[model samples]
Target chain A: MTGPHGYSKDKDAHLKRLRRIEGQIRGLQRMVEEDVYCIDILTQVSASTKALQSFALQLLEEHLRHCVAHAVERGGPEVDAKVAEATAAIARLLRT
Target chain B: MTGPHGYSKDKDAHLKRLRRIEGQIRGLQRMVEEDVYCIDILTQVSASTKALQSFALQLLEEHLRHCVAHAVERGGPEVDAKVAEATAAIARLLRT
Candidate 1:
């Protein structure tokens, strides 16, 4: 049997994006090490942040479409739990 | 004058969260190098993914509240551009 939510169909894509983000992080480190201008470093940081955010948003959509949608279709306590889980997730995201 | 979006008020919080995520990424790399069990690694990956998503969501909310909202208030081509920019971002996130 599969684990709680099974495996994501887009797992590979997610990993690839993460690896790229890792590289970006290293790039950011190098920029800092080289004493890049304050605004320039900030700009790179913003871009890296956006890339990571994009990756996260894609995963959230997948979770909702696959895990959450599947749990919702089953219709039981799992449905409530899954909905709560997603709601909690969204709440965390919205939290400042 | 400030750059396109000026600067985020919660910039420090965002940086802190991203730094935490960098640690998590490092932890994942260690898990892999150590040759942890497949399922265990996958589980950790899932958790990291969620954490990153939460960070991104928070940033997106901030962009909407500050950048997008400010653009709308100003009213011009900038408003259209900002709306389009946010829409493109959302679309990117939604992509499977």
Candidate 2:
């Protein structure tokens, strides 16, 4: 299930984390349905958000350490493209 | 910047949060470059990860509340499409 960056090494771990996040989202929905207090629901929402972001950062780190590093070592147009792609991804994530 | 969801109301806030995340990532790179203790680096990584996840969850919530809800209200094939799209997105985020 790896992408072009070959991040599949930790694929299982990533999936597990994501499944938990899905659960968290479901919980948030239920909380809303049950008319939970605003602050309490927001708190859980915060927790869920943190969990997802943590997963993203770890994925990004692996991409940098493995894919980007190898591309840099190869040293050519691919390197420029990889760097640009990674930078753009970072920009996108920040905007997100 | 808002996309179809018209999430522009909080665009400034999202951008600000993302800028902070960009700084955190940069700080992480510096930490690795400086050979910071592995445990300490991991701790900071955890913090940064949490921050990013929080952002994502919030974004998803907004997408569901504003975008998906509106689509559902319209009541047509687009409603199903929007729900499917959102579900697929959740699946992707979880896999990530």
Best by DockQ: 1
lDDT of 1 by residue, A5-85 (tens): 323544556567767777766665554444443334444445665665565456567667767787778878898877776
| Candidate 1 wrongly placed segments (more than 4 Å) | A1-20, A26-96, B1-7
lDDT of 1 by residue, B44-85 (tens): 545655665565556567667777788789888898877777
lDDT of 2 by residue, B28-59 (tens): 55554454433344455556556656766776
Instruction: Tell me, by lDDT, which candidate is best.
Output: 2
lDDT of 2 by residue, A1-96 (tens): 124343456556665665666566556555544544333444565566567567667867887787778878988889887777767666655554
What is the C-alpha DockQ of each candidate? 0.07, 0.04
TM-score of model 2 vs. true structure: 0.49
Clashing pairs in 1: none
**Pairs in clash, predicted candidate 2:** A49-B53, A49-B54, A50-B50, A50-B53, A50-B54, A52-B53, A53-B52, A53-B53, A54-B49
TM-score per candidate, chains pooled: 0.52, 0.49
Error of 2 at B51 (Å): 15
